[model samples]
Target: MDRGKKPTTFFANRNNKIYMDLKDIIRENTLRYLPAKSLRRCTSVCREWKLYISTPFFAHNQSNSFHDLSGFFCQSHSSQPSFISLDPIAYGVPDPSLKFLPEPVDIRCSSNGLLCCQGRTGYKAYYICNPVIQQWKKLPKPDANHGCDPALVLVFEPSLLNFVADYKLICAFQSDLDGYEFDIYSSAEGSWRTSGEICFGNRQIVPSTGVHVDGIVYWQSRSTVVAFDLTSERSTLIYSYSSGSLGKVNGKLCSASIQGSKLTIAELSNPYTNTMQMHSKTRAWSVKNVTLNDSVFAGQTDQKSVLFIGGKIVVIRLGSTLISYDTRTNDIKQLATEVDYDPRMIPYVNSLVEV
Candidate 1:
């Protein structure tokens, strides 16, 4: 080798070693701190990064404290919808069982790892089952006079009491001209019983999606959020938001959503404010607002909220597409397409079960 070109081999090896170390650090710390949106984008970069990021550690980190499972963005073609599992994060990986659900229909998520799916083709029966574990049971039509919203399903929370371990599945339907009525069914009981009718005034909007928080299913319609406590087996009004203020929160039956996590309750305005409160420790909420180009906050705001993911507040927008917001880095990115499933079809995100 010429004297002027000396030490090229040693320098090349040294640089390669440094590059390798940096890549390892990026893989480890990136999974730790990167928002799910950015992490997902990194996975799409290449195969090596995909394998590194799709590990149980990464998935577990992305998993909610309530239940970490793959949520499907599905569509229906039949009247009797069924629960089938799909790899939501995996890119085009065909799921053999996913083919069985040829007849797509509307789906609603419930507690105890159950999903309530109704068909679009006919007035057949409603199917309630867990897609992950594949343990499913069906429900025939409600009583002759009892017509409930097959889209509504009640889910039960996990109990520490070993002897009294069971989950509840509830559904809402129309019985009379009054409005909407509800029925309660328990896996322990295996029977449907009348709960009550919920009549939201014309001014109050009932969000199609009802989140179970604190042993009660909560829903936000136009302005009101209602809760139905399972222990008492009754519905109770929780909170209501005015027209200007958009109220949206997500979770199953647990305090995990409001606690210190990636999920947060933020306020965004012209100043771009964001905040999250801990419902357990304090009633107070953390607030932050920024002055950014109008285009930044231009997306859909009504279906916007911060979700708790791995102890961080991630902004989620339900629109033509699903967007997750990362507050720590002030990053906004799209996670899934709106064509997958309507956010209104299945309101809750977490699958409540030991999957």
Candidate 2:
């Protein structure tokens, strides 16, 4: 080898325009798939990276790729809340128990990266917080009494230009009849507003069964599936005679429940389809029934919580075990053993979203 000159190595192309373009393209695409924590740290890598990561479009893209279930905030009246992560690296929050707040809270509902919690003290005010960033916002209490078991649903849809997520919290206040009315709190307005729509004359909305998908929030009872559209501000019965739990599976509204040894997972096929066609000749759901190998199940299956771990995975409590059942593969795996019986588990997505 000639000692006078050095050979061009792999990084010698670093100065080339085409090489730089390729590197930028790869970096941008790779950044979109990283976990939110890594993306938060990536902002400090460089000013350009920082600007890109902070963009709303980038947040939307990253959110689409990072929709995996981090874990759940298991809430109970007897004990303090707990975080149960399926994978610590992917689903862990900075403070799982939400100790950063001023007071102890009951984790009511969660959407995207935010949580709706009711304070255990002083009029039981509501709070919305991002546990990953340890930021929270206290909401003004509504005029309606939510009662002991309030029906609360948090709705958040991250748009391409929506970096600071504008969320809506729907709380069902009881009507004079057996029905319930909703008080929707908008984060953008920093206030609560009552909606005219009422889940009227129906059984009380099951607070734990609430799940938001698309722009609609769903709560299923033994007789029907009740929904409130965030855009239209209307409550509609989506499904009927559905004794199941509501969750989002594979990016669609799904209902999962265990009956005896058989597991039924129903997907809400089309809510926007022609309503006349839906009510008359067709059903809005496409369902799948999976039979389990074991018959052992937790007590009070009717009231037990059903949570979706991620894509095609349903987590339910069996005795003291938290088991995740894969609907696609019919595989069952134990997530947490010796869990609280019939724990009120609210699914949490660990993200860098701010309150």
Candidate 3:
């Protein structure tokens, strides 16, 4: 070795290997914490990084850590939809305009940050999109070609099966006869398949939005509850005295009915039983009553819509005024008032859910 300069001898190869391992660990943690938008841009960084971020496990973990209510998707009278951020402190900027939706589309339903929309004038187009990420996919039209309006439900849960790429879109409509039929579109299958037909006898499937509980979907009819098992592809009708307005309250399937100014909530409960049940015992529903203040019921002649917006907060919409009733503290908060139309507000949480 020369006296003036040091030779090329450095740290051992084992030390360099350890340093690279630490670098990889740090990179993974950093990628996991990044928001969905940034992580999507990072996919083009390198081949290895792209593969890692696209994996189901990585998407699942990122979704679990990044769970938060981004905002509400509001549809105005002009049939144009916009996203209003719920947290003004975090996203105080102007409301984001939705450019992904078609010009004249009907805003149907939303679940787990995904919106299910259909074309107003045609039956060929159906879309599932995430307004936050501006990502959308057009669904293949169902096999049945009917003109009846279909009830739509969108279900997307990233934490299930450690995958964020799976989703289910269900469409139920009245058949030509006096019965109801369903068509389910699965991302795994990439096609729409018709499910079993359910004859309502004399009763009809009262038009209402579907409420998802666990993995099953429930719809309230006149005097019964239609429960669709997404896993088994079966439909069950349970007799219920609910008001045809169904929602999930405190993580349980609940039904709400408004009588005068009193709002009644009933939850379906399954109790432990040791004996063999006869004819598939029906689950019991416990009832709780909450009286709405005069302000909520003032100048409201039309029927009110009730929805549970997670965390014990019940949203009541009567005409143009939107009121939120907190079940925990018994406090009522007015969210918004005087809108262009009756806002179809859905409980939404932003995630990196790929449809």
Predicted structure with the largest lDDT when compared to the true one? 2
Most accurate candidate by TM-score: 2
Note the Cα lDDT for every prediction shown: 0.45, 0.75, 0.67
Estimated TM-score for each candidate: 0.52, 0.81, 0.73
Model 2 earns a TM-score of 0.81
Q: How do the residues 246-307 of candidate 1 rate in per-residue lDDT, one tens digit apiece?
A: 22234322111222223433331211111234443422223434332234345435444322
Q: Which residue pairs collide, candidate 2?
A: none
Task: Name the lDDT of candidate 3.
Answer: 0.67
> Can you tell me which runs of candidate 3 are displaced by over 4 Å?
1-60, 66-70, 76-78, 91-97, 146-148, 160-164, 259-261, 270-283, 292-311
Candidate 2, residues 14-109: lDDT per residue as tens digits?
Answer: 668777797698677788877776677778877889998887677667765666667788866767789888676655766677899999988888
lDDT of 3 by residue, 1-355 (tens): 5678865666577789998897688667777665565666678877878899888677667766665555566665465666545554442112244555664566677776677777766664888876655677888878875344567778877665555467788877776677777788898789988887564555556443577888778777777777778888777776675663677766788777676678888877852222338666554677788877756576668667674445566677766766777677877767677755655565565566665
| Candidate 3: Cα lDDT at 65 | 67
- Steric collisions counted per model: 33, 0, 0
Instruction: For model 3, name the residue pairs that clash.
Output: none
Is 2 or 3 the stronger prediction by lDDT? 2
